[model samples]
Target: MQDVKADVYVPGHGPILKGASALDRHIKFYKDLRNIIKDAINDNIEATKISVPDTFGEPDEGRKNMTVETWLKFYG
Candidate 1:
């Protein structure tokens, strides 16, 4: 996104985002989530015990457990 120099971003979901700052925030979000899951795996945290930060934005409650399960399947 930074290399492309786009003025706006159309995400897979949610409202349309504008500006580079929006892209930066999106990048940070995924990076943060990846790191959190990685750390949890390293610490031997159970999939059922892993948690996302409350401040990470409003995620779908129904998909939260599935997300953790998918992450563990690939990275665990």
Candidate 2:
């Protein structure tokens, strides 16, 4: 979107966003998630033990509803 210089962004869920500033939170969320997963892998933590933090913000309902076990099976 930013590469394309789109004026508006539509996510898979939730309300539409406008402009670069609107993407800040989402960009941070992805960056944080990447860091979390990397650290967990480095620590040899089981995927089943990993949980998304509340500080990561409200996940989509589908993701919010997914269990840790489900995530493990999906990612592992």
Candidate 3:
């Protein structure tokens, strides 16, 4: 918010919000990403949480890789 001096913002997967609601989605997004990556790691398809959409940092070297859909199912 500081970057834009704005009070509200819309998250990637949810609706826009102007106050605590915005914060709620932000936190959930992080938690969701965490679970997603954890599942990937458990399944041996390494992944990590990140700020930007489809923009995770380097994941651990793995023997195989998969599509985002696969990750979502694993994550869900």
Candidate 4:
């Protein structure tokens, strides 16, 4: 992070962030993803249920949201 004067950087799992704030972003991402998937499944959006899950991994409520197994079930 000290390599340059960059104010914000996007980590692997979170949005563009500065230091510790990235952790929170990642958590929110998972929670939101979980809700999105659950909504899609309930709505019977068959296409999205397959494709979105592929791109977005598993749904994690509090860090255990998404898993590889979850993704494989649809878009694997």
Candidate lDDT values, in order:
0.77, 0.65, 0.52, 0.51
How much is the lDDT of residue 1 in candidate 1? 56
The model with the greater TM-score, 1 or 3, is 1
Worst 10 residues of 4 by lDDT: 47-56
Clashing pairs in 4: 58-66, 59-65, 59-66, 60-65, 60-66
- lDDT, candidate 3, at 21: 51
How many Å off is the CA of 35 in candidate 4?
Answer: 0.3
- Mind giving the per-residue lDDT tens digits that candidate 1 earns over 1-76? 5777788888788667798888877787667778879999899988777776544565686677887888777777
What is residue 22's positional error in candidate 2, in angstroms? 2.7
lDDT of 1 at 33: 70
lDDT of 3 by residue, 1-76 (tens): 4255457776575557677655666666557666666666677763333222333343333411344445556655
Model 3 alpha-carbon drift over 4 Å, by segment: 1-17, 46-76
Candidate 4 regions with alpha-carbon error over 4 angstroms: 1-18, 49-76
Compared with the true structure, model 4 gives a TM-score of 0.41
Model 2 TM-score is 0.54
How would you encode candidate 4's per-residue C-alpha lDDT over 27-67 as one tens digit per residue? Answer: 56556656665665666655333323333464454433334
Error of 2 at 56 (Å): 6.0
Cα displacement (Å) at residue 63, model 1: 1.9
Put down candidate 2 lDDT per residue, 1-76, tens digits, no spaces.
Answer: 6676777899888668787777776677656666666677668787655656565465666675464445444445
Model 4 residue 41 lDDT?
Answer: 64
TM-score of 1: 0.72
